[model samples]
Target chain A: MQREVMFAGFGGQGILLIGNILAHTAMEEGYEVAWVPSYGPEMRGGTAYCLVVISDRPIGSPIIRNPMHLVAMNHPSLEKFAPMVKPNGVVVINSSLIHIGSDRDDVDELLVPANDIANDLGSIKVANIVALGAFVARSKIVDFEVLRKCVQEQFSSKEKLIPINMAALEEGKKVAQIK
Target chain B: MGKILMKGNEAIGEAAIRAGCLNYFAYPITPQSEVAEYLSRRMPEVGGVFLQAESEIAVGNMLFGAAGCGARVFTTSSSPGISLMSEAISYISSAQLPVVFVNIVRGGPGLGGILPSQADYFQATKGGGHGDYRLLVMAPASIQEAVEMVMTAFPLAEKYRNPVMILGDGLIGQMMEPVEFPEHLRTEPSNKDDWATNGMDTRKSSKPNLVKTLFLNAEKLEEHNVILKAKYDRMKREEVRYEPYNTDTDYQALIVSFGTMSRVCRTVIDDLKAEGFETAMIRPQTLFPFPEEPIKQAALKESCKVIISIELNMGQMVEDVERSVQGGRPVHWYGKAGGDVPTPEEIIDVIKSFVS
Candidate 1:
C-alpha cells in the first residue's frame, strides 16, 4: 500500500511541518516513508510544498507529479493542486482560506474551516495541526493515536505549545466529523 | 537497525558521518547546498569538521589538503561549481588521493538552472579535468542507494587508493527516502604515520614525507599513468554494477538507463508490458566501469533486436552503449537536456517507434 500526499501552502503556513508529521507517524508505524520538500529560490515567501510517500515496501521514486492526496491550505494551493488529485483520491481544503472549491466528481473533497477551528481553539498558528487532524479523521491513512504521538514527539521540546496544539487537533477532528 | 525518514542531502551527510568521514569541505550550490547545510549542523554534533569554503575551487583544494593528511574527507557541488573543481580533481587523481566527491548534477554546459539532469555523464566518466585519469563513478537511483553508495565509497577509495565520486543528479540530491544506518561504523584507517607530513619522531630515520603530483620526469609520469591504469583495471573487474529487469523474456527492445532515468524507464517498461510489448531494461549503477560485459551479452542476444539508451541528457551515456554493443545491434539514443527529464510517455513513444 503506497500513498502519495502533498501538503502545499505559503512558507509560513506550516505545510512542511504537516508533511514531516505525517512522514514521522508513518515511520513510527513501521512503514517506509519519504518526505521531500521544495527548496531553491522558490522556498522563501513563495508557495512551499512537500511530497510525502508512505509505502509497505521500499519507495522507488520520491518525486511525485500526481499525488493521491492534496491538503491545500490556501486559495493558490487549492487552485494549483486540486485538479492534480488522482481519481478516487481525497482532497482536504481549508475553507477559511480557499475561496474556490474543486469541481472534479471523481475524487472526494472535504472543505474544513481549519483556520476558524484553530482560532476558536485560541491559536491561529495551529491551523496546520487542525488540517492534519482533519486529514487523519477523514482518510484514516494513519491511526489518530499514532499521529497524536507524532505531534507530541515533534513538539516535545517546546513543552508549553504542546497542549494548545493538541487542543487544536481535537477541535479539528470535531469540526471535520460534523462537516 | 532503525529507519529514519531523511531528505536525500541530509542522508548523504549522515551516511558520510557513519562512514567515518571526519572532515567535509564544500561551497554552496543550488539543489546541493543542503548537503553542506546538513553537514554544517550534524558534523559538529559528531565531532567532525565541516568547513564552508569561500569557493568551489577552494573547497576542492581543501579536500586535497585533508586527504593529503590521510584523513577521510569529502566535498559536494553541483554542475557549474563542479566544473570549477576540475583542476583540483585532476591533481587529486594524479596524486592518487583517497577522497570522495559528490556531484549533485544540475543542468547545462554553463550556469544552468537548478534542476536535475544527467548531462554530466561525460564530464564525470570521461575525465572532466586534464590528463588521463578516471574516477570510480557511482550513480544512485534512490535516496537509500545514495546513502549506501556514500558509505561504500570511502572503503572503495581506500582499497584502490584513488578518488571516488558519487554522481547523482538534482533529483537524487533533493528527494527523500527511508534509510537505515549501517550496522557497524568502521574506524577510518590511520595512514598518517606512514604518508602524512606530521613531524617525524627522533626514533625514526630523518626523512620528510611530501605529497605532490609534480613528477617532472616524462618516464616517471608515464609510470604513474600506468599504475593509475592498473588500479582502474582492477576496479573494472571487481566493482562494475548493473541491474537487469525482465531480461529473461524475449524482449523486442532493451533499454539502457541510469540514475533517475532508470526509474522512469521501469515505469515505461511496465506500461509497454501491459500493452503486449515485451521490453527489458539494463540499469548501470556504476558509470565508470560501464557494466560492459552484461550489456554486451544482452545486446548479442538474437531475441533483442533494438537497444535504446535513455538519459536526461542528449545521449551522454549513448557512447558507452554503442561501444558495448559493438554495432551488433542498432543502439538508439533518446533524451531531453537542459534540466528537462523525459516523461514515461515520451520514453515509451520513442521505444514504440523503434520497435515498429
Candidate 2:
C-alpha cells in the first residue's frame, strides 16, 4: 500500500502546497507520510516540485525516483513528467494549462480543466485546490473529509480565506466526479 | 512523543534545543543554513541564545567562549566552512571543552557544489586539525535518528568532557521525514566551578581556572595525547554503533556505507534481493570509533566474498574499510564526487560486476 506522487509546476502555481496538503491528509489518516520539496536556488520559478509518499507501513526510502502518480499543473510539468509515469499508474493533468497529453496507453490519464473550474468558482488561484480535489476523487488515497480538515487546519488562522477555499475544493470535487 | 514531518537540518536544531543546548553560535552555509535559520526562531521561544556569528571561524571561537563559561553550545557548517573551524575544534578538543559541532558535508577538495557528499569521512574520523585527538562522531541516516543522535550527543560530550559531532551530508540536511521528539527534560549545566571561568568569588577559591590548549612542556603534551588516546580507545570499545542488514544469509557481497549514502545502499539491497542476488550492508552509525570489529569478522567469514565501500567521495572510507578487512578480502570502492549521489541501480550494477 505504498504510493508515491509528484506534483510539479512553476513556482507560484502552488505545487508545493498541493503536495503538502496531500501529505498532511495522509498523516492525519494514520498513515506513514513524507513530503519533500525542491530546495536551493532552483526553487524560484524554475520548475518547483515536491514528492509525497504515503504508505500503510514504515517507508524504506524517502526518495522517490519512480512515482506511482504525477499531477502536472502546467505544460512544462506535463512535458517533463508524463513519460516518466509508471506503467498502470495515474497521471492527472491540468488541462486548462497543459495542452499536451500523454502518448502512453498503459497508464490512466485524467485531464481536468482545473483553471476553468477555479475561475468559474470566482478565483483563478484555486486551480491547485481543484487539481488536488481531482486527485483525491480519482485515487481515493485519502478521504475527502480528512483532506478538508487538513485544509482548514492549514488555513485556520486566516479565517477570511477558509470558506472560499472549502468552496473551491467542493467545486473541484464535483467537477472531477462529473468528468 | 508523536511524529512530525521535519527536514534533517531543522530536526537537528530542534533536537539540540530539546537536549538542553541553550547557546548556539553558527554562520550560514548552503545545505546546512536551515539549522541556523531554525535555531534563530526556535531558540528565542525557548529562552536560548542563537547568535549568527561573523564567520565559521568566529562561530567556532564563540562556541569556545560559551563552553568556557560552562554553557552547552553547538554550531553547524559545511565542508569549506568546517575547514575554517577545524583549528578551533582542535583547540576545544585539547582544552577538553564540552561542545557539539555538526558538519552537514558537501563535496570537495575545495569550494565544491551545494549537494550531498561523504568525502569528509577521513577528515572527520582522522585528525582534521593539527593535533592527536578525536571527536566523538555520530552519523544519522534518517531524520528521526538525526534528532535522537543530537539529543544523545550533548550528554556524550558532557560525559566525556570533550567535543562531539553530528556528521551528515547535504542530502540528510535537505531531506524530510517524520521525527519524534524525546521526552521533555530540561538539561542544566552541572559542576560549573570545576573548570568554568565564571567570575571568581573570594569565598570559593584563590586560584583562577583557565581553559587553554597550550602545554608548553613537551612531556606534558605527550601525556595529554596519551590520555586522549585512552579515552578514544574506551570510546571505540563502548560507543561503536552499526546496523547489519541481511547478515544471517550467506551473502555474496557485503556493502559498507554510512550516513545518507547508506539509505541508497539499503534500496539497492532490496532491489538485488528481488533479482535473486544475495547482498548485505554494514551501515556505520558512528564514523569515528567505527564499528571495525564487526566488519573485520564479517570480512574473515568465507560466506562474504567481496567488500564494497560505497560513498559520495572518491575513496575516503575505503581506506578504513581496507584496514578493517586486514587484506583478508579484496576491498573495492565506488563513489561520485562533487555532490553527486549514486543511484541505487548504479550501486547494484557495481555490485553485480563483483559477483564471481
Candidate 3:
C-alpha cells in the first residue's frame, strides 16, 4: 500500500521538520519514503509545506498532487489541503491555531490542540512533534514506539530537550485517543 | 549499509566523495545550493576541499584548474548559473579534462522559476556551450539512482576524459529519499599521469604535459574537433543506458521521458494498465547518447503506433524522440514549462487522447 502525508504551516513552524520525522520513521520501518519540501525563496511566516510519501514497494512518483492524509498546522494549510485528502484518510487539524474542521465528512478529522500541549510541556518549539505524534497515533501508519525512538534519535545531539518533547508527544497522543 | 534519508542535492555531494572526488568548487544556485551547503561542512571532515567561488564562471575555471592537476573535481549549478559556466565547459572539453557538472535544472531562458523543469534537454544533450563538444549527460529518476549516477559519472568522465553532467530537475534536488550508497562504486581517477599536468616530477615523466584548448590553426583545430567527435561517438556506442517498462505488453504508445518526469509517467503507465490501456515507456538514463537505437527498436514494435515525449519543458526532448524514431512511428509531445509538472492524471489524459 502507498500513502502520502502532507504537513503544512507558516514557515518556521517546523512543518518540514515534522514531515521529515515521519518520513524517517517510515524508513526505519522498512518502507520506501520520500520527503519533498516546498522550497526556494520561501520566507518566514509564509506558507511552508512538505509531502511525505510511504510505500510498501518503491515509490514511483514523490511529487504527489493529492495526498491520502494531512497534518495541517494552520488555517490556510487545512483549508487548502483538506479538500484534496482521500476518503477515509486522517486529517489532523491543529485546534490551537485552526478553529474550523475539515468541512467534508468523508475523512476522519482529529482536532488536537498541539501548541497548547507543547506549551504545557514548557516550550512551543515542540508543537510540530506533538502534531506528528497525534497524527501517527490516530493513523497508525507506523508503530508508535518506533516513532518515539526516531524522535529521540532526532534530538540525540541536543540531549536535554528529549524529555519535554516526549511529554508533548504523549499529550498529543492522549488527545488523539480521547477524541 | 542501512538506509538513510537524504535530500538529492546532499546525496549527490556524498556520492561524489564516495567516488573519490574530493575537490568541489561551485557557486550556489537554487534549487541546488544545498549541494554546496552540505559539501562545505562535510568536505572538511573528509579532508576534502570545498570552495565557494565568486561566480559560476570562476567555479567552472576552478574545476578546470583542479581537474587538470588530475584531481577528481565537480561543481553543481542551476540553469542560469550553468549557462554562465558554458564557455568554461567548452574550454574544459577541448582540453580533454575529466570533470563533472550537475545542473539541478530550474526553469528558464533567463532566471526562470526556482522549481523543477527539464528545459535544459537541448542545452545538455546538444551543446549548451559552443563549438564541437558534448557533455556525457545522465538523468536520474530517484535519489538512489542519483547517487549511483553521481558515483559512476566520475569514472565515466575519467575514462572519456570529458565533462559529464548529472542533469536533474529541481524536484530531484529538493526531494528527500532513503538512499543506500553502494560500497563498490568508489574509484580514484585512473591513468591520470598519461595526460594530466600533475607535475612531470610527480609522474617522473620526461614529456611536458600541457593542457590547453588554444588550437588556433585550421588543421590543428579540425584535428582536435575530429578527436572530440570520436570520443562522443564512442560514448554513443558504449554508454547508452535506458529502462524499458512494460514493453512486452502489446502497448500502442511508447513514452520517452527522463528525470522526475519519468517517475510521473511510471505512475501513469501503471494506472493506464489498470484501466486496460496498455502503454510502454523507455526512461533514458543517458541523455547524451540519447538511447536512439532502443527508442527506434521500441517504436518499431507492431503494436506501438505513437511515440510520446513527455517532459517538463515545452517539447525539448520531443525533438530527440522524433529523431530517434526516424519516421517509423508518429512521435508526439506533451509537457509544461517552468515547473507545475504534469500530474499523472494529466499524462493519463494525454495518453488516452493519443490512443483513443
| Best candidate, DockQ | 3
Question: What ordering of candidates by DockQ runs from best to worst?
Answer: 3, 1, 2
lDDT of 3 by residue, B285-340 (tens): 99988899999999999999899999998998889888898999889999999678
True contacts kept of each: 0.46, 0.30, 0.74
Leading candidate by lDDT? 3
- Give Cα-based local distance difference scores for all models: 0.87, 0.85, 0.92
Question: On residues B1-356, what C-alpha lDDT tens digit does candidate 2 reach at each position?
Answer: 67777888999999999988888888999989999999999999989998988888898889888898888889989989989999998999998888999999987888877888887888888979888889899999888888999998988888777889888987789877777897776576666677778767822877788898888899998988898888898899989999998887788899999987888888788888888888998999988888888999877777888999998888989888898998999899998896657778788889988876
Interface RMSD of 2: 2.1
Candidate 3, superposed: residue stretches over 4 Å from native? B184-188
Q: Give the poorly placed runs of model 2, Cα more than 4 Å off.
A: B200-207
* Per-residue alpha-carbon lDDT of candidate 3 for residues A42-94, written as tens digits (9 for 90 to 100): 76688999999999998887888789999999999999999999999999999
Residue B104 alpha-carbon offset, candidate 2, angstroms: 1.6
lDDT of 3 at B222: 94
Q: What is candidate 1's lDDT per residue for A1-179, written digit by digit as tens?
A: 78988899888989999999999998889888878777655847789888888989766555667899989998888889988899988799899988788888998888888888888888789999999998888888899999999899889999999999998888767766875
Candidate 1 chain B, run of 10 with poorest lDDT = B196-205
lDDT of 2 at B312: 85
Q: Per-residue lDDT tens digits of candidate 1, residues B112-133?
A: 7878899899999999999999
**What local lDDT does model 2 show for residue A87?**
87
Pairs in steric clash, model 1: none
TM-score of 2: 0.95
